[model samples]
Target: MQIAYLMNTYPVTSATFIRREIAALEAQGVSVRRFAVRPWDQQLVDDADRQEQTRTTYLLAPGGLRLVLLTMAESLRNPRGFWRAAKTAWTLYRNAGRGALVRHVAYLMEAVHLKRLANGCTHVHAHFSTNTAAVALLCARLGGPGYSFTAHGPDEFLDPGAASLGLKLQMARFAVAITEFARVQLALAGGMGIWPKLHVVRCGVDVTDLRPAPPPATDAPFVCVGRLCVQKAQEHIVAALADLHQTHPQARVILIGDGDTRPAITAAIARHGLGEHVELRGWADNAAVKDALSGARALLLPSFAEGLPIVIMEAHALGRPVISTYIAGIPELVDQQTGWLVPAGDVPALAAAMRACMDTPPEELASMGAMARARVEAAHDVTRNATDLKALFSRYV
Candidate 1:
């Protein structure tokens, strides 16, 4: 069967899990077409993602006039579909706040463009229940392929009204939640009717691609991988490191991602006199990330919110235990056995965890690392989860 995968921006540094999902499906004989609303203009560190950008069709790349002309031709060719899409757009404009009218109109135009391009596809699956899902809903209304979407938390659940997540869930043929925690949130927002359409499909990593590296022989710097954003709380990590330095002066942390919060992170490093202990490596590709994980004492992520971060799984797959906050779907993957779990925003507790990682015996840390790898093998195997996702798509198609 043929399928179209829709994304807001293709090959984003943090959302590589989506790329893995698409590759796994294609490996199993699924004919998949990749579509992005816009091209990612940021510096791409991964060669694989750079290659994927060439294969994806960007809907907004043809300029405004071309989009208007193509949309007009599509409307003239299929008047009934045009009316259906128009009615849907009108409903969204009326029900969604007045400020969203222009955005909804843009979604309608993009839907028309997608309907023209997505020929011979049996289904369309989008990654987020935000803008991409809104466009997918309109695409279905415009006589395009049946559409579904996956909802990852922190944003959609925090502000469902602004996101119009409930309406998107009702419109989709099926909906995917990355964890049971996310599924429950979708049910709460969309009501009991959404339960039937919701499925739990985790964002996973390929274990075969990850070779287990020996644990660090001595105390090594901890590594954190994710966007340098407020939600990730990298600043908190910097603060906690200051407290940790009083006891374990040798403790160091290397943050391996980039975002708007870099200035604040840099300030924290300078403010706390952690310049020597903290290092910002900007963005690294999957290969570089693996190399970073292989030599680390542990992986640290003091996030205030998450949808079960793929970096946690990647760290586990490489036999590196994780130290993350107990928020969102994080508890489902991390525990005392796997690593340390601290409450979010508690600097004292975060510092204590960092100190524990430094003080723990090498043999005990290695044992925990082994358990971490075993857990990932059992729950986050990309090949197995991709088969389950394909089966779900088959049932709908």
Candidate 2:
């Protein structure tokens, strides 16, 4: 089967799971074509990502005028399909407000481009229920292949109406939820009529490639891997580390990603006198992330919201425990045996968890790490999840 994968930005550091998903499908003898709405900035760091940029087609890379011309030519070729897509865009505009209307127009143009490029693909699957899915929905309306999308929550669920997620669900051949919590949220937002089409497919990790490394000899420093953004709550980690310093004077944190919050996080570290305690290592490639996890005491992510962070599974696959917030789909993966789950935004609670991890016996921590790895092997294996996804796509294809 041939599938076209649509993404707003390809090869983004934060969404490596998407790349893995595509690779897993191809491994199972499925042909996949990648399409990105816009070219990612020069910030592309990973070698794999650079290679992907060469292979994937970018819709807006040729500039706005070219897209406008393409849309016009496409409309001239198939006026009925163009009218159907334009009518859908107008409906989205009326419901989602003026700003969304402008965005949907851009999505409409991209949809036209996608329809032209998506040759021999049996289905179009988008990774998120955001702009890329918007384009996917319109592409289908403009006589493209049947489309489906995976909705990773926190953002889409935050304002489903604003994003017109319900309409997208109504139009899609199927909708995928990464977690049960996300499935429930999609049901609520999209209504029960769309429930039959919703399926729970957990985001997964390639455990074989991430075999457990020997734990660090000492639990002095921890590692946190994700974008340095507000939702990640890295600031809370900084605060917690400050509190831990009062007891564990040698406590340190290696932040493995970078974003808009870097300056603020740096300020927080300095303000809390954690200049030496918290080190922002900036963005690292996947191999570098695994290497960092190999040497770290545990993975720390105090996100206020999430859709079962793939990093948690990665940490588990690497035989490292995680200390993360208990919000969204996190509790399903993290537990008393695998790792600690504290309430989001609770600095005191997070600090206590950090202290407990630091104080735990090495043998006990190793046991927990073992259980963590076993959990991922059983539940979040990428190859297995890909098989499930392929089965789902086969039904429509």
Candidate 1 residue lDDT tens string, 1-397: 9999999999898889989999999999999999999988898889999999899998888878888898888789999998998898887777677698878878888898888789999999999888899899999999999999988987878778767778888888999999999999999889998799899988889999887788785868899999999999999999999999898888889999999899999999999998888999999988999999998999999999888999999988888889999998999989999899999999999999988888888888888989999988888988888898899899998
Kindly report which residue stretches of model 1 are placed more than 4 angstroms away from their true locations once superposed: none
Q: Ten consecutive residues with minimal summed lDDT in candidate 2?
A: 212-221
Which lDDT value does model 1 have at 352?
Answer: 96
Q: Against the hidden true structure, what lDDT does model 2 obtain?
A: 0.90
Q: What is the per-residue lDDT of model 2 for residues 1-397, given as tens digits with 9 covering 90 to 100?
A: 8999999888788888998999999999999999998777748879898888788999888789999999999899999999999999888877788667678789899899899899788899998898888889899999999899998888889888878899999999999999999999999989998899999989999988999878666744799999889999999999998898899999889999988899999999889988877888988898899889988899999999898999999999988999998899999889999999998999999999999999999989899999999999988999999999999998867
What lDDT score belongs to each candidate, Candidate 1 first?
A: 0.90, 0.90
Candidate 1 global CA lDDT score = 0.90
User: Number of clashing residue pairs in every model?
Assistant: 0, 0
